[model samples]
Target: MHSSTDTGPDDAVGVGAAVMLVEDDRRVRTAVAAFLRAKGFRVAEYDDGETARRAVLDAMPDVLVLDRMLPGLSGDDLLRDIRTRSDVPVIMLTALGASGHRIDGLELGADDYLAKPFALRELQLRIAKLLRHRASRQSPLAPFTVGRFRIDPSLRRITCDGADVVLSGREYELLLFLLKNPDRVVSRDEMLREVWGWNSGDASTVTVHVRRLREKIEPNPREPEYLRTEWGAGYRFTPSGRSS
Candidate 1:
């Protein structure tokens, strides 16, 4: 469920991002969520991974703060599943001194990892940094080529092999965002903010758009080329349509 409450100060950077927090511990979850809300983010908190897994597919938050030891699906399993279809920037929290856990999380496509007993401020700063990093990769206003797909942001158009490929408003926006971050894994959170102007919403909107986009650009949507899913990460726009 999505709960909207204001916390912190209005002076916090008003990026209006939404954060989904998955933690089994009530105390830790409550404290961290309070801090995030204060930082001017909309937060949806979950106590277990099973419920979160279902909710995330429908209502994908901009960022996910996941704990490794979760009930039901477990953090690592949930992360692995999310990476299959959606690229939502995930920051995983593991036990202190568990180097193996940290390594496993990263290998599973976690954007960042944190040990328990860390400062909330540090988590805040990490989230801000991740958001900034994603923003920094915004594509300039220009036409670009990714494989046979020719994109004209100025014209809001795409063409494959000289044939026009029509896209809906959302489709156009999604494609543009991907093209801008070429060869990089773009989480669903970044897509929602940049393309939909939403701090939080159904992530299936993104999943649908991606499928439609692949239909138009890829030679075969079932076996995609230009738009590929990075397991444990997110979607990537491979410019050459060929894996390097």
Candidate 2:
């Protein structure tokens, strides 16, 4: 519904953050775009997923607000396609507020999800939080050594035994957090808040990410060396592996 050239004022905290909003509903899209623009976010609005997808592939935005249901392409499929190429943070918006739907979105690599009939302020807050977390991760820092693995936050890269290890954005963030708090048991609740920037959500999201991280970083995911579960407590990161 809106052109890619549309931009807001350059003075707010979200001055440089562009939000690509993909929603088929005219009423919802218009209202949401107005609020975001008022808040000083440059917005590129689309009513169909195909156009939105192409736009993002051409030039990824700082964040994406996607609707689960859309014409041309469904949000779920679009999300899957994006995961293979970009790590731009995504927030799913839909009338489907069921827990299963939320879980599916998270599993598909969405950074956040908000049900319809939600507060506009909450959406803005969520976007702000995600951007802040992203900025913090890019802060200059020395490479961290954890056993045979080395993590460079600035470059957003990780290596194991000097070999490159691929990781998703969320996985990288989780690993970085665990590495920073080595030797301590970090509860799932704490992880949700600190690592995911989520005040509350399903604990399984943390579990899923941890499992994926261990698979890539550990010799065996079944019996992880660096990433260990604390059973009733949560998870513990052994910087020096099991030998430590």
Candidate 3:
């Protein structure tokens, strides 16, 4: 094994953050990525929303830069699909003619919108602002309290009855996802696509994350108090003292 340290910037494209750009045009992709990277970010480029979606799960970008017109999956469809699960920040880039598309993207779930033929500097600024805003908004809920546990997203810290608990990023994402949607039965596929963006069979990964989340957040760990399993479907987040 080898010891390591961060090679990326303090706010790496997504060290604790990332900006995912999904554009079909290579020119735009290169230009945008270079601009973002120049700004001290960890940037991931995708050609379309489908791939972007997968990357989003895998990389967990802090913000998504989505082009309105895509090849296989339309940007609108991707936005709608994303809304059903995660609330990762999204910014839509559309052609000037597609003004209606811009409005439509925001209606679905996009946090911000921009028209094409845009300035690289402006886009970089937009993504930066969104990421900063998202981070700020997250803290109040990061170390959220259930019955006895607290989830800390920043440090990936967890505490139960004031005792220290550690959680992996995947576990933190899955558990935080569920906690935000308390009392709901989240399906495995949804968790996969949203938490880690697994398009295929990754049930085991989901299981592992959930189990880890339970071990840290659950009071009994044997009989989980927060993360609950649904035999055939998936899992649920039960705020403490809630009955199954």
Candidate 4:
């Protein structure tokens, strides 16, 4: 494992954020770590999945930048393990840019995906956005009820029918966004911008999260009661469970 820090200007968006970066390529890992450090982030670099996994389980980072292909445990396996334990936002890096591969990563619970040979500046921006979202979730807010679901913002917990419903970080955010805009049709582009903090990205990311969220929150995912798709537009959340 390698680490980098700088006494440089701390005005960057990731100033106080600790970033865990795992990549098999020494050159890439070193370069990415150096770049993030210069941007005011404390970076811990690891060369393989197993080492990174141990470190992550020990102390979760603010954000994780993980390569899809790794030495021992492999990126997919590592991500699976991490998701089972924590909701730390993950940005997956891969050489494959195919839509199917991106979808698979999202299904595995990645918050974001970036193809390799990516610009360092883009990576920095993505990290900054994620950090901003993480910070926002901490703000205190009164708990509210929407249909069968009761949301407690302060605790970041949701319960349905008095039973706790487990949701990933991304899923929680998506559900919160929908709950805030009840009965309104929200486009995929809008969801990407508002929820994922992306100006442009594959819409499948939203679709995958929606599917996962429905599985958790909806009694029948096949016929979702709350989250309804508006064909040709996007999605709508009807807290009353009334069919449109």
In terms of TM-score, the best-performing candidate is 4
Per-residue lDDT of candidate 1, residues 12-109 (tens digit): 54258989999999989999998787777888999999999999879887788999999889999998888766666678987753666666775565
How close is every model to the real structure, measured as TM-score?
Answer: 0.56, 0.88, 0.51, 0.92
Q: State which candidate, 2 or 4, has the greater TM-score.
A: 4
**Clashing pairs counted in every model:** 5, 0, 7, 0
TM for candidate 4 is: 0.92
lDDT of each: 0.75, 0.84, 0.67, 0.87
- In candidate 1, residue 114 scores what lDDT? 81
The digit string of per-residue lDDT tens for model 4 on 1-244 reads 2333433232467886899999999888888988888777999999899999999978999999999999879999999999888889999999998999999999999998889788777787788888887787678999999877789998888887899988888888898888888889999999999988888888899999999998997889999988999999999998777755
Off by over 4 Å in 3: 1-16, 97-99, 141-244
RMSD of each: 10.6, 4.6, 14.2, 3.6
| Cα TM-score of candidate 3 | 0.51
Candidate 2: 10-residue stretch with minimal lDDT: 1-10
From the highest TM-score down, the ranking of the candidates is 4, 2, 1, 3
RMSD of 3: 14.2
Candidate 1 backbone clash number:
5
Cα TM-score of candidate 1: 0.56
Runs of candidate 2 with Cα error greater than 4 angstroms are 1-12
- What lDDT tens digits, residue by residue, belong to model 2 across residues 103-161? 88887888898899777777877888888878777779987787767988778888877
Clashing pairs in 2: none
